[model samples]
Target chain A: MNQFIQELTKGLWKELPPFRLLLGLCPVLAVTKSASNGIGMGMAVLFVLTLSNMLISLVRNIIPSKVRIACFITISATLVVAVELLMQAYAYPLYLQLGIFVPLIVVNCIILGRAEAFAAKNPVHLAIADGLGMGLGFTMSLTFLGSIREILGAGTWFGYPVMWDGFQPFTIMVEAPGAFLCLGLTLAAMNYGTRRQLMKRNREGSEASASPCGGCRACSIGKSQD
Target chain B: MSVFEVFISAIFVNNIVLAQNLGNCPYLGCSKEKGVALGMGTSVIFVTVMATLCTWLVQKYILIPTGLEYLQTLVFILIIASLVQFVEMFLKKAIPPLYASLGIFLPLITTNCCVLGVTLLVQREQYDLMDALIYAFATGAGFLLALLLMAGVRERLETCRVPKAMAGTPIALIMAGIMSLSFMAFKGMV
Candidate 1:
């Protein structure tokens, strides 16, 4: 239970796909102009990631080492096709809006990265948890970033008008340029926050020690290791 | 669309990397150095042309005839992955210098969405084999053009004193965004 929680929550912040680890960046910048589209893409990814992870984990032992990557891609591609068919059938408009990205999900490095990095080595349960966690993390980031872009660009939150009548929307936010700038700025802010937290922790630890314990090389090396 | 228009449009207006948001992973990762960027770009051009041509033939003859269009994703991706592998080995055997330059980026191209995207687009747009091949070549050339431009910018960016947080992917993406905005001007310039 505890390990499962660890596997899940790790993806939420510590290993957030887009912002932290910089995985699956295409959809992050391309399809995230609107919150609805972001959420929709996220859901599609969530479905694919969870199932692929589970299936890959189950067959990890039998797969040949040389051909495993190809095998993993084949599995995910099949699932992506299924997702594409389902979306086309039920959510025709959204599916059309998504365009080639639906098929492109088969090549999303995040999914393949997880299958190789986590699922292949772990038990099925942990792999599924990791998948759910990473998927949720990716989806949450997409939705949040999308909402911000949507609100600022279109003056709407999930297509509802949120700004004052006279307020001018930052039209760039909803375009390709806006997606890049927003993600860049957001990543910078997160990095700054993490650095500040790490610095605070170091300072607190240093304050508790009165004696000078390290010289130039050792102190620099210690911080570098941290 | 005429072949000339397709070539020009893909090169400038519908750039796979800058506009379509395809091949971004390798676009960002391999655009650091000019030589590497060129090598990656050339390999992409080769793979794009070959993959689209092969997939088009497969879709038209095998999948469509057999009523297996639903398996396009699985089939195309498998074909692409293997195509990349075959290209890698053939390149290594035939051109050692080129192989050395491409190095790891060769394998990375296997997962590049631009190649698959072009192949799928060829099918979706219903381009005949010759047109599909030309379109793929155009898209590949467009990718090369964007990558070279980006590599030049990044090379220049390295000298400037950037902020701690925005030094890497953040700034590269912003630069690409500006480039994308600029590329919009070339739209409909047949």
Candidate 2:
């Protein structure tokens, strides 16, 4: 039980997909023009991830090592197709808004990375947990981006107006430029937080040590190894 | 309608990179180095042209004729993945040096949204085979051009002493914004 919690928690912050690792940004920037689009894309990804992970986990040991990547792609692609068909049938409007991204989900490094790293080695239940955790992390990032861009770019959230008419919406926020701005600022904020934490740790360490001179010895050893 | 318009629009007015915003994975990831960027650009041109032709046929004959158009995405992706594999293998045997430079990029192109996006747009626009091929090659060339320019700027950005917050991807994003705005100048060409 503890192990499952550890696996799930890692994806939320320690190994967040877009912000931290920067594995998948194509869809992150393209479809996040609105909050609804972001949530819709997130759900599609979640469904694909969970289904693909479970299947791959169930058949992990039987697959030969040489053809593992091919097998995984086929399985994942099949699930993506299934999801695409379901979306087309039930939610045509959202499906059309998503456009090519639904199919592009097959190439998303997040799903493929999770499959190669976790599902191919672990059991089905754990794979499901990993998928849910990672998918939610990705979804949360998209939703956050969507909210910011929608509020700033269109003066709306989920297609409803928020800002008064007098306020000028930054048109660039609705275009490709806005995508970059949102992504860059969000990543910089995260990096700044990490750097502050590192500084705090360094300060605490220095207070405990009698001399800062001795720390250079360890630093030099580490540098030499590099 | 004219070939010139197809070429011009694909290159500037409706650039795959700056306007449509496809092929961004390589645009941002591989644009740091000029030589590698050129190689990736050439590979995109090659694969995109071939894949567009192949997809045009499948869409016309197989998907539309038989009412399997809904399977377009799945079938198109499969065909593209296999075609990329075949091309990589053939090139490895035929031209070893060219293959080595472009081999790593071949696999990446299989999943590039620009390649698939062009193919789908060709179908969506109902272009003939010749036009599709031309548009695909032109768009790929545009992607290459954008990457090379970005590579040149990024090399120079290394020395510019940007800012604490907007150093890496942030600065790149801002640069992309500027590029998009510049490209907007050519919008009326269509």
Where does model 2 exceed 4 Å of error?
A: A206-226
i-RMS for every candidate: 6.7, 7.1
Looking at candidate 1, what is the lDDT of residue B44? 88
Span of ten consecutive residues with least summed lDDT in model 2 chain A: A217-226
RMSD over all Cα atoms, model 2: 5.2
The numbered model that scores best in TM-score is 1
Candidate 2: CAPRI quality band: acceptable
For each candidate in turn, the TM-score is 0.93, 0.91
Residue pairs in clash, model 2:
none
Assess the local accuracy of residue B38 in candidate 2 as a C-alpha lDDT between 0 and 100: 98
**Regions of model 1 farther than 4 Å from truth:** A205-226
Task: Estimate the Cα RMSD of every predicted model relative to the unseen true structure.
Answer: 4.9, 5.2
| Candidate 1, residue A155: how far the Cα is off, in Å | 1.2
